[model samples]
Target: MRATIALALAAALAAATSASGQDLLLRGGPIHTGEAQVEALAVKDGKVAFAGRLDAARRAAPGAREIDLKGAAAYPGFVDAHAHLSGIGFREMTLNLEGATSIEDLVARLKAWDEAHPGREALSGRGWIETHWPERRFPTRADLDRAVANRPVVLTRADGHALVANSAMLALAGVTAATAAPEGGQILKDAAGQPTGMLIDNAMALVRAKVPPPDGAARAEAVRRGAGVYAARGWTGLHNMAASREEVATEEALARQGLLPVRVENYMSLAEGGEVLASGPSRDGAGMVGVRGVKLFMDGALGSRGAALLAPYADAEGTGLIVTPPQVIAQALARARTSGAQVAIHAIGDRGNRLVLDAYQQAFAGDPAALKAARWRVEHAQILSPEDLPRFAELGVIASMQPSHAIGDLYFAPARLGPERLKGAYAWESLLHTGAALAGGSDAPVEKGDPLVEFYAAAYRHDLAGRSGPDWRPQEAVSRAQALAMLTSGPAFAAGREAELGALTVGRTADISVFSVDLLSAPFDQIAKAHAVMTIVGGKVVYEAAR
Candidate 1:
């Protein structure tokens, strides 16, 4: 079945190619083939036939159509190891609060959105961080109510683990001050014990359940729009974490129509792991979509103090909340194991990471060989103790991570987690040195889903402005080469796709990311400012910057 899908996809790409056909010669100044230097590449039937000197490439594919890169550098098309495919599209289509600088800014933006789209049953968006706001606190439900009264509104924090609901939204969810928080969630209350409309982790689901689900048309549009956004930034593929079954079907359906611009590995939500497994591993349409993994959340994020932590947060009064209990994690892992599906669990804090590790171990203990082969991952393996750092490689688990989280979290992590615990936070280098592989991502819609931003964070270990302090942990900074690997091969490994993707090797898909500057040797600022000149997926030019 997999072979059939691969062939079908190749045929689709071949059909898309011009009269020159499937044979092509691509010559560029420098090509980072995830190894030694390469000057040119030959593509045949959407796969790399050769990657070496121009003469050798030409010899390998005689009479092939030629494309001159004109001094641009080529690298493996980047893979976002973790991100929400549908959410990114929705973010573009809905009210975007990513730029709101304060609570007032956020409310103002919501008001403007309300005015623009009057009579909306609900106003939904993401990308607001209260940490950077002048108020330095989450906005209450009253705040949102004041901006757009009567209509329900729910705006997610940048971390995606929490959201502030307007009074109407709260009422729709039937949540009030008297309503107790869920097992692994919180409903922030006022001094007088009135509901604040702030929901964390499981609590957010209450109001979220009431939001109208997007129709098929909306999902299809999101796929098209989001693909273009990633392609423009040079992404050849992305790991769609927490994709619903409907989303998986939507992407596959789009792929069938040759509308999918990039490859997608759909990690369907673990809540539906059984159904995904029953459907089995399959690819369809342009063969640009794959369904073989499940995404599970073990805890919330730190910004909201919902991430399960071993110790109480320095600024908050509690350790953290475990969104998914240990027993549930164990059961999910076991179920995923039976289906031979890869599992990626979201574990953000020390306690969360610890519990997930335990669950994975317990599930894998029964069948050691299966465990070794599963390539199971812990998404956002962000915080950990030194004792648990080595367990990743030891257990053969991949650390699916997002570097953007580090720079964003650095702003307030010091206050949330004291100086002592800071060392174990965002320990990228530490995890690498311990023999664990790191898969880089942006967690898009949660952060700016830009590969350059993620690379800057990993390579520089500082905020976007080059700001860093003792607590920023400069020692964890990785070399640029390492950073690139994290974005490319690292993610490929996590997806179990290193054999065919990640590198510009012979027989691999001709997916390439062309940039204006060499990311490895260029100045830090140039690397940051570097623009993608072109992006090719399966040897087909998906994006080309205007000359």
Candidate 2:
């Protein structure tokens, strides 16, 4: 029965491709429609006009400009299911310390930035991780003081859940040993009971509150720059996580001006999204930007040892912190249900995942229909209790995961959780086997935010260096087809736009991404090295690589 339906759809598509009047014709490569490979595709207005034979597409769109793929691969547009768009732009603008090999290197970069911009009042930078540092410890205030003794220096960790503030900055924030860490936060201290300048999770807000906020102009530019970067990297759209209402407005303004190169679906932060939740979802006139839901954090990231865990960490002492209380999550769920808004909560540890699941189950008490209809998601569903694996599918919750995290975090995760808990860490294939849909993303700024890298990571389950340890669980890696769907249809399904945005079918929006290599057939190692040849959104060419 399904075979007959598929054949009829194919025949209808063939007939449509034989008709006339399209705006663009794409040929000369394998065009994958998530169902079959086609010789050509035609775009009319902003939707797919046809997908079939190359000769028929040429006849159907005689007046259309043709795009020769030159052996590149084309597929339904890739949408990052999770990311921080503005942060990606800010990383470009700020004192980026993304690859500092050691604490001294990080300090040297800070010194260089400080010397280059001597007039600035304070120093702020991000993207430093101590995981691979030779010293094997987080940076300290004393370390940064060597770079800028007089000025306040605050540098955030790569995970965005922790920061190291120099003594000057700590004094400016009035944080001392006597100052108590807020709930769900930690202020690390030395044995002498002095503040060590490392703040985890909620505690980072203390120093951040002291930093000057970016003005409206700066904020707008970040959005613009971030969108351009994503488009250039071949991303057709992104699910912007932790977006502010102001950021949403900025995106809408950009879309109105036709300055936005890629589609944006925002999940505003819970603190700033009350109005949006009450008003329901909204989209720009051109359908380029939309506010789809609200984002909340259940726990901090695993790298910082702040992820709420069921058991104590193998290396650390505690069970980790809970950033948001269970009651708050329950209230948010209830509100989302009433307002018809989706809820995406960040859950990274076993305890965190279980708490979120518990809240969801409680909210879904007697309404099985609403449970599936809500399409609620757990962002970064990274660590989980083996027992709770089936709960995601049973509750109809989406697991919006970033493949790069598995490859990156595995470097230190085994030591943190021990081998006993390794079974449920980044278990992508396990979740899928249990009937849960997994949406893929890069978590940009946090990771490199490159689609090709993300695809490679998902399929290979190894670090960029092509290395993996025994406890890394390489078996959790997905197939090429599954990875492709995660980047396309899975995200569409998660966002409740599957009918209109996921595939290259007639009447669906014409969004396509062309890459240098055939992602499905390329050698695993070569996938990450491939670049984006072109990016198209709504039939408009947003980015094209030069020959």
Candidate 3:
């Protein structure tokens, strides 16, 4: 039966290829329409015109240019529901320490980067996780001083919730032994009360404020470079989770210049929400960019031990820190409500998730209708208590999760949360069954932003190395079809773009992702080998892999 279908598709594609330019006619391979199986698709004026048989598509758009996909499978272009575009760009331009396996290795890499860069005002980079290190200890100022004593340096953890600064950087920020930890942040100190140069949550902001902010030109370039990277990786759209007014301006500038390769739905930062919202939500002419939501950080990440857990960590005495007090979050929600903006809160630990839920509940009391319509999200949603699991669906909160985080954090999550809490960690299938939407992302600069990596992790529920043991909780694994939805329709619905994007339906946007291998049937390990052969957005080919 499959062979007979393949022959029919070949004949149709031959007819399509025999025609000249009109728009686009894609056939000769599997086409996932996000509804049911389809033999082919046609695009006209940046929107799908036909999505059934090739003969019908040709009739719908006569003389359309044809692109035979060969045997590669095509699906709706993947959406990264949450990611940091500027950060991903900066990681490429700066000293990326994600490869360091030990404290010494990190320092050595930094020293080499410093030597190559020559005269920089300050050295700044991200992508280091202490959990994976051989020493399993956070790098201190003294350790960084060994590499460069005269200059300032701040290296962020892969989770982006914590950072380690050199003494020079700390001194510039005026962090001293007497400095008291902020209400929702912590500055780790030594036994004798000296600052240890490790800053978690809001504390990192002190040192960050001292570093020079990138200029407008640099930020514009970063957006361009980042879009290219995502396009090449098969992403047609992303919800840029953190954008300030200046960054949005840069994005608009890039859009005007016709340099953006992917679509962006930007969420203004909670801190800068008022200013960014003054002009109201902005969308570019081509719908390449939209700034209509607000992003808030409720707590730090789990890896830094600052995730505001309901119970104390198995290895530590106290629970984690709440980066943003509930009162502050409530205020942000109130402000966002006035502007009719969607809210996306970063909540990792169970306690963090509870606090955010409580805030959302309070915010929706006066306007229950908004609650259902808002489509608010809980970013990370990494660790949820059994009780809080149902509240996500009940409250209409989308769970914006990153599959790679499961693979990355699962290595040490057992040590941090112990066995019982592990049940709720990165529970993708569990969350889906609870009736909540699951929007997946890479959180690039936090992990390698690859669609295949995210899909593999979601489908297999194991680390890239496949080193999981018996207690690793494979029950949370999602099926390949579910994984694909999390990357496509799930995100499009979360962003309220389901009507226009996320499917190869007639009249929908012409965005598609063609892969070298069929993800639905690929072997677990072979999934990683699948490459994006083509990425199309708005009826234009944005990326095509070299032969």
Question: What's the TM-score of each model vs. the native?
Answer: 0.94, 0.95, 0.93
Q: lDDT per residue, candidate 1, 1-547, as tens digits?
A: 3243233334333333322235778785688888866989898888899999999999999988887888888888799999888888787888878868998999899999899898958889888999888897899888898898779999998888899999889988999878988898998899999989899889988999999987889987776667667776788899998887777777776666666778899888866667765544556645588886788888889899988889899997998888876777777676677777788889999999998888888887766667768888999988898799999988888999899899888888899989988889999999999999899999998987888888889999877777786789998989988999999999888877899899988999888888888888887777667777777888887666655
Model 3 lDDT, residue 528, Cα:
76
Between the candidate structures 1 and 2, which one is better when assessed by lDDT?
Answer: 2
Superposed model 2: Cα runs more than 4 Å off: 1-22
In candidate 2, which residue pairs clash?
none
Model 3, stretches more than 4 Å misplaced? 1-22, 275-280
lDDT of 2 by residue, 27-63 (tens): 9989999888999998988788889998888777677
Q: For each candidate, what is the lDDT?
A: 0.83, 0.88, 0.84
Question: Which candidate number maximizes TM-score?
Answer: 2
Backbone-clash count (model 1): 1
> In candidate 1, how many Å is residue 153 off?
1.2
RMSD of model 1 against the true structure:
4.9
Which has the better TM-score: candidate 2, or candidate 3?
2
Q: Pick the candidate with the highest lDDT.
A: 2
Q: What 10-residue stretch in candidate 1 is worst by lDDT?
A: 12-21
- Clash numbers, per candidate: 1, 0, 0
Q: In model 3, what are the clashing residue pairs, if there are any?
A: none
